[model samples]
Target chain A: MEQQNELSFDTLVIGGGIAGSEAAINLANLNYKVILVEKDLSLGGKMIHLSKVFPTLDCAACITTPKVSETIRHPNITIYTYSEVKNIVKVSEKKFTATLVKKPRYVNEDLCTGCQECEDKCPVVVKDQFQYDLVGRKAVYVPFSIANPRVVNIDIENCILCGLCEKVCPVDAIDFTQEDVEIPLTVKSVIIATGFELFDPTQILRYGFGKFKNVVTAMQMERQLVPTRPYNSVLRPKDGKMPDNIAYILCTGSRDETVGNPICSQICCMYSVKQAQLLLGALPMADVSIYCMDIRAFGKGFCEFYQQAVGMGVEFHKGRVAKITEKENGNLILRYEDIEEGKIKEVEHDLVVLSIGVLPNPDAKLLFDSPVIESDEFNYVKQTDELLCPPDTNIKGVFVAGTSSGPMDIPDSILSAGAASACSANYIRN
Target chain B: METKKIKTIDIIKEKRTVSAEAKQNLKEYNKIKKLILKSLESEAKTIPQIAAETELPLDVVTFYLMTLRRYGSIETGEIDDMDEYFSYKLKK
Candidate 1:
């Protein structure tokens, strides 16, 4: 038999998002050897890319970076970035075994210094996905400035292999022969904190998201408002013009049967309102409008935040946007039904933002073989008792946290992670 | 220099060709890039002026200029008289 190169840990946290980081830190502080596995090159998930979070107007990176740094530097926590858990099998009542595959970054982690020499020399420029394709990144790139590891990974598929990057590296860190490394992990407990993916707006043809240049998603606009924004200022993508009027379409893909997602995304409305306020600050003389079926400000101080936007001269149209059409000058014409006035109205705006919904990422379900991990009707990880024990999955000693269980805001995600960590710790002690 | 460095260079040279689609795309990009560089050879120009000179779409011109700026081939200068768009110049 081949030797199983097995490493053991007290607990395994399957993601490095806000919830996963919180859970890992809590577990590590308890003096438990915890392993945090993240598929991305960075520790902070989508939160780091955001400009500012809702209700607090706090810089999203400001809140996330400290936690990320803490998680990475924690003595009891070991991090695996650019890695995935292939299969996780329940070994016993209290033990689980997992197969982790670490993808090659083609750069030696120990030797590399985070310098831009290789990035500057590379001639191939591709869409920067971290910036939501609003800008170009070289084939060899660190995902963003605040990426935790702050090391560049070569996009092997897109790399022309002209040896420019290899030649420019001060330290001989570029290794083309690097291959994926498989790691077997034995753990006493497992926490699934794999987060959610945003709903793609292209499926809703009526919104004209892909066809219309000025029609951007909420996340894209969030990037534009950030300090490391793709552009120097917020200009409409179609003609590079400073927009005067901007409209927001709330609930783009959520609560709509057509897209097959019927539940409320629980964050789109508040985020849209937040973006509207930020846009007004960015463009002082610009007009902002929001069209929504209903203002579902269900969280603490959320209603006050919505009202504050209204107080700041933001036009809140109680309506449902039916369709959007592009004008000759890259402006947008929105056809919506005004619910309060009971009239169908057509309005023009230079820029429109589609507040896309959150969808459950079902990737964690594929990592288990026996005692098949259960998913609810909406495809989120099933919680046996949401009120009593919110983080317990169907399998014993295994837990689910954050958006892996369902759609939740950042505060809820953190609370969920705490619960999962506590429950796992208790389970381990018993 | 070293044998290991020479081997890496040889591997890169052997495997450096782009795909058909990428090659065609690069060819088109180089064509537009050359035109923009030629137009900016005499003086720095705003995005709209470059668009007009190159007869390219404003979005296309802006994307290319931004890409060039990112790769250190171009740099931004003073804003236009209207204070709307910044002028771009070739990096010396």
Candidate 2:
């Protein structure tokens, strides 16, 4: 209890995604005592799933790994991976006490050296959740190559009741008996950097995502296209065939009231183009079509990059997709009214990639002392307009950043992360 | 010993906070009289420059500038770096 009560920091960050990861690192660099609490076992968030970043096409892992590494190594940062915030209380004015639920990894993280030998010996195999169920890994396995803390975890339910790991433990690190622990942390402020969740195409029903193997979400495609990704290459999961034509449906759940998110996701169009580039690069002969309403490249060099994507033989359809059907030969058939031709047309392709929209993460609504400010139905935080009397929220020191504000790309997320850092600093910066 | 060269941490020793001062104003116009006079002595700073000085996100800087202008505390003078930014100098 003393250990729990003794732990306190200047800031508590919920969600270890790009926004929280970056926000925690930024705050720690500013010399603020920080506790970065992530519900998942790893950081990096959706940014990790991305194969290549937009505008620059830099390797997503290459850029995100350093930030992950920095967050883990920063002296001021206390990272609680595989932990969830259970309660938040304002004990004093402008201060927050947060109770966190830390799920058991079932292995002694302090003693385990991340040696995968135990995983190799384990007889159980489970679907790698991080891979979108595209691949299988041992029940006791590291989530990814770059998971922060770089430690392995055991899937207790899937374990084959084998005691071989315990017999061969050099450090006695394997602990199947460890129970779930609750950690309480107090801080001056809290930042809800909980990133967005993917919109399920099953909501639209016309896409038939769960039934169609050829049809995939843009996130699934990213996992496939990323070289370091579990599968290592792109192929149809249905028949294991490398198809040459892929059609991308942009704004699948974005800008549609029936699907619930009507606001522009703001980043779908660019990521769609980037995925098109990756597809073209992977399979040079692949013919690609992007059914998009508009291409917004508002940032610096974004428009030019979009133009270059156009030059690279990716067709830009200025219309919405009406429907997609699975063909006999495991091909995806896209049927939509070409706004340009004013006629309904159908095209057959090996894969149909849904550029899904981003919405507020479900876990963002955890803080009890300070409430998350809502600007849109999508839950992007609203900002006060007047300069001198700008409207910050009920939370004294906490601020919003990245896609938590709306659907923004890496550059925009980075910009918001910086802004939140600045405004949060005004309260305690001196 | 080095003289405190032009105290960069320059702050007013006014007895009232900004909110308190606003409450004590004789009239809406008369109330902002000091703020107007104070803004006259400020100068505008660009977005990047402000980010460099304040170490904040560009969006926050632009956002805060907008708020300051609306409150008659700051004003925008020019566009640089392909985005419009404001100077920190007080608005008259």
Candidate 3:
């Protein structure tokens, strides 16, 4: 362990996602010193991975990139990427000291010029988790092209000692001698915007998500549609063939008692419809269908989008997919119960996407031990009043925002983050 | 506090030794890589064609093809109009 470094800030934000970034920027604009900690090498979270936002179908990166840049360049904000909040101890009503562990990136942040020389020369190739493991990335590479603090991180686990990256570096930025350091931060208030994780559909044995290559998650489909997509176009992973008939199975891991998550993951219905619309435009001759228990197009302009998808000839079936099996030619067979027709029917599609639900990030609980930040039955941070004080956690100076509180869309998440920032700012002022 | 400096190459060498499980995995990976290279030797072939000829799973073939493509061992030739799959040829 290296010598612990002590720093003080007006606020400490636990995540570097859209919500946390928004909160940090808002507080920084208010002339408050804020420290933002992220568990990944990059600042942008799930939003960066998305193709586009709902209803308006605006580019997701377009909305996130500016915020990430602003947060990174903000003078009042200090970002600690690839760091974790190990413990938080409350000393006073409005003061808390947090122990953070900053993992080594193996490259000196000040020396790296964000060039791709090291990445180009590195011979070790591993699955790129940013692309949902659909493609390969060099062992020494940045998280993405537009990543804030565009510095290369050496994947120490997979890196071979070939030293090609070091030899080819123009500025000699590659360094493997770095070790993890402990950072102690004292802050007046805390904001929890740690985002949600997608439910792993592989637990549902019948869905065959991992077993069948053609059956992918909704996020994987989003990756296929993004501008920085893994492939040239959307193709089935099993054979890299353009799929003519694609099926979307809604509520794969949500609203199911068996999976222990019974809440309706509020964004799945709209996103599935959005993806169906995008797929129709991308592959005009192909047939796109969505199987769901119900169409909950409850957001503003969302019902209109659903209607627009219907008008575009996208098929919407009111059914629950029972099982999915792969065919001999890498196609998928979907067995679903047709509630409208009152019969169980089988449909075949070249590709299938499982609209998995959201769950609270399991790390939120592990970050704090002092005030015992209470969480609801669903593991979302418990709010004093779900209607009134939505961002107020049991801890006095601590606030929860975004999907960390519950399931919400991008817009709602931004609003919740705004609320959290207001709450933290108010606490810091008084 | 007195601190000693260490070479990056020394640290990298210390961490690069493969475990038994990793050794087995590397062996399997090389075997699949060789099969893929052999399949693309005669002519350019699509992922499905290579998978069928080599009697390997399509996902396994796809993973190795991606690895080989990253290593500059394979290059995409053309998209087959019939199935819309890209043909990959071994790099000369």
Candidate 4:
């Protein structure tokens, strides 16, 4: 057994996503020591995978990469990617002890260059999760081109024990002997910025997500619009055909009691609209339509963005998609109820994108040992003083941020993170 | 150096446990990979053309071709003007 490592910090941020990264940077800038732990292999979270952010249409990676770089270079911030917080014990009002488990990447961070030699030599091929499995990756791969730390991880489950990656490595960084290391840390305050999970569209059999090859999640369509797109263009996944008619179904699992997530996923409307606009530009002749119960353009300049999409020939149909059936040619027949006309309608599209909603990631609550952090009926972290301080968790010195509390867009998530960091700093001072 | 490499392989074999399902998957993937490479040996072809030649599903052929493309085993050529499928060829 390896010797356990112990560290102490002023604050511990549970996620390395946008909110968590912002909070960590804020505290670090304030001369307070902060540790950021992320479960994935990289610092940039789901935001990095997006093509362009809503409203501004700014490149998503352009926004995330600099923040990730800043977070990495900050003197007062420590990051633990490919790690999870197992348990957090509140020792005192001003102090908490957290136990983290760091999973091995099988490549030494110090020696391995971001070179693709090992990835090229490896014989095994598996689904690339970063590309949403639209493409395949090698057994040993860097998660994505812009992954923070830009290191490769060995998928031991898929690796064939072929030793090809080990042999081909210029730095000999592959270390199969590496094991999971337990890290114990003492922090003065804790911030729960762990993010939300995308509602799986596969759960809705009526949408025909997995059953219909042309039907994809909104994230999958977003991936095709990026520079690192898998297909090089937004094409039908079934046959690689250029889609002539594309349909976006908003609120796939949101604002529906049957799906058990009744609250609106605030960002879906704008993101789907953004994708529709991008698709229209990419395939100029293709017709793009968005079917939604209603367009909830709530944020600043959001209504203008919606109107811009409408002006750009994005057909906005006020309707709720009931079910989808696939033709032999992989075209999807959407059966929907027209809310404006109060009539049932059916339409065919070459490709369909399901605008899935956000659901609360309840994994963060399990880390607490005493006075378990309370979550709402929907499993979002219960904001005890949402009106006064939206970040205040029930437990003193513990705060919540981002979609860990509820579904929010990027701007609101950042605001929530700022509030959480402010509340944490105030608690530590007092 | 060869002896040291063999020893490391032995260590991996001892330490790692490969499941039956995983082994079966590897075997299947290798077989499919060989078939796809063989079909692309003579000339560049689109995914549908490869699928037709190999008598495999379009998704399966696309998955392997994309993987090969990413890893530099294959390269994509111009799109077919008729059907819009990109022509793939074994990398020289």
Query: Chain A TM-score per candidate?
Result: 0.98, 0.93, 0.99, 0.99
* Candidate 1: tens digits of C-alpha lDDT, residues A301-390: 999999999999999999989999998888899999999989999999999999999999979888798768999999999999898999
lDDT of 3 by residue, A23-99 (tens): 99999999999999999999989998898899999999999999999999999999999999978988998789989
Name the lDDT value of residue A96 in candidate 1. 92
The TM-score between candidate 2 and the true structure equals: 0.78
TM-score of each: 0.95, 0.78, 0.95, 0.97
Best by DockQ: 4
Q: Please compute the TM-score of chain B alone for each predicted structure, in the order given.
A: 0.79, 0.43, 0.79, 0.83
How far residue A297's Cα lies from its native spot in candidate 2, in Å, is: 2.2
Task: Give model 4's share of reference contacts.
Answer: 0.40
Each candidate's fnat, listed in order, reads 0.22, 0.00, 0.42, 0.40
Candidate 2 lDDT tens digits, A1-430: 1124446888887778777877788788889988988878888988877788888999988888898888888999998988878668766655777787778786789998887777666544445678776555666788887677878887655554445565555777776656567667778876767778888887878887878867888887888887655432466655435557888898899889887788888888888888898889987878899998888778787898888888999999888888888877667778888899898998888888899998877566555534444454456555454244232544556567677656777876776676666666666554
Q: CA shift at A222, candidate 3, in angstroms?
A: 0.7
Candidate 4 lDDT score relative to the true structure: 0.89
Interface Cα RMSD in Å, per prediction: 2.3, 29.2, 2.7, 1.9
Model 4, stretches more than 4 Å misplaced? B1-9
Model 1, runs deviating above 4 Å: A1-4, B1-6, B9-17, B77-86
Specify the highest-lDDT model's number. Answer: 4
Q: Kindly report which residue stretches of model 2 are placed more than 4 angstroms away from their true locations once superposed.
A: A1-3, A369-376, A382-391, B1-92
